[model samples]
Target: MNHTIPLALSIAGTDPTGGAGIQADLKTFQEREVYGMSVITSVVAQNTIGVQDVHHIPLDFIESQLKSVLSDLPPHSVKTGMIATPEMMEMIAAYLRNQSIPYVLDPVMVAKSGHALMDPASQDIVREALVPLATIVTPNIPEAEILVDFQIQDLYDAQRAAKVLVEELGAEAAVVKGGHLKGEAVDILYVNNRFYTFPSIRTNTKHTHGTGCTFSAVLAAELAKQKSIVEAVSIAKKFITDAIRYTLNIGNGNGPTNHWGYRLKNIPTVKGENHHV
Candidate 1:
């Protein structure tokens, strides 16, 4: 009997719309065959349209939640997203100091809806407190730009930025996703003294609501299963690609990708059809 269940935890914000944040993370975890746990840092009033409001959970409550979960059911891997303030970063970093679990940091600075998610004052706190502790930092084009105070216009620039992030910012590894780039979506991961690229044809749709959360959460889930960083990132790239291809039109502004895309494809159907609904 296979009693080996990988446990993954996500420390992030709550998305009331169930399109991103903790909701997306949990979906990715389940998709990757992992048990998911969550410690929410903030509750967001949002829809496919945009984020209307955000309420930060108290630092003490965040601490208590982490303690409760970590004490009883320690996760094999953990990932962080959308920490709202400097206090939240400090609180999480302090708690992480005691544990040596592998962690992925999704530096969620700005929402796809064009709203600022992280406080500008908290950038330094996250860099000093969270980045160094993380096993890998997954930052998209804009987030990577913010992290190093530079612009990434192409894959060459992304490679340069990844090195800078690891050397200058003290991150163990960095993946600069090029979803915002033109043409094919080329994500670059810098690790083990090499750069690996995962390229996918850009989907011509607006169902990218949870791409970041899903990618980072899938990385965490892969790590929880003892997969190497490079292997984990490769798997996550395929996961996101298929997910975007199977996107469901959920809202007017932008829809959400289907986390169960693979499962949906696997279900038995009448033999005559060549396409899935």
Candidate 2:
């Protein structure tokens, strides 16, 4: 009997704490019932408190790692996080430009402890070489603001930025996370020329270490299983909400999200609305 599971690949940095970046992505893929593969871009010496140091893999080695997994495993979907340099972005983009599978981009710029993971000078390169290749780009408030080059004060701004990510930057869709907003955490998604909102009651916890990576990874996993775009986002949203609600307090500072939180009962149902704004 030949049995196979959907495979999802993550190209990102590594976290020794097993919270964010490649580790978080792999955890998400596993919990979502997909086989996970990884290509490490950077080795981060960081824990919950903050990032201490980072060692970027050589570009040639990075390319080799990419080819090793992508060539043989051939994931059904792929996502990237912590693309620190322009050269790394371009190399990954070149390989993904023609792949028909879903490509989820988590624009991981800063860590939970306010450490900069990406180079400041590489923003322009990211927009030009990466944002366009994303089937869907997931950006929290700060990242979204940077991508759209505007201040986002409310849901309207988020919707506008989401549209910009799709219409102006050429992503198939965009999710402008509203975590920075002061009310219910409402994430707006722009896809198929329409806007949709997925709102969850704010979980007042500092353990949202890998929320972004986990969200995007679940999106990729669901897509690899052949779920529709809307379906995938819906699942991803619910998964993250639970993970955040029941966060893990392992590290001294902002801890990691509970990857298995979805297993718990009575996860409040978060509904999404379709809007024409």
**Residue pairs in steric clash, candidate 1?**
none
lDDT of 1: 0.84
Scored against the true structure, residue 49 in model 2 reaches a CA lDDT of 84
- How many angstroms is residue 116 displaced in model 1 relative to the true structure, after the best TM-score fit? 3.2
Clashing pairs in 2: none
Estimate TM-scores for all models.
0.92, 0.96
lDDT of each residue in 1-277, candidate 2, tens digit only: 2227899999999999999889999989989989999999999998888788999999999999988986688888999998888888888999998788899999987556555556667887778888998989999988888888899999989999999999999999999888889899999999999898999979999888888999999999999999988888889999999999987678898899999988886766777889676
Candidate 1: misplaced stretches above 4 Å?
A: 1-4, 264-277
Could you tell me the lDDT of residue 4 within candidate 2?
A: 74
| lDDT tens digits by residue: candidate 1, 148-245 | 88889998899888877788888888999999888888887787567777787677889888889998998999999999988888888878887887
lDDT values of the candidates?
Answer: 0.84, 0.88
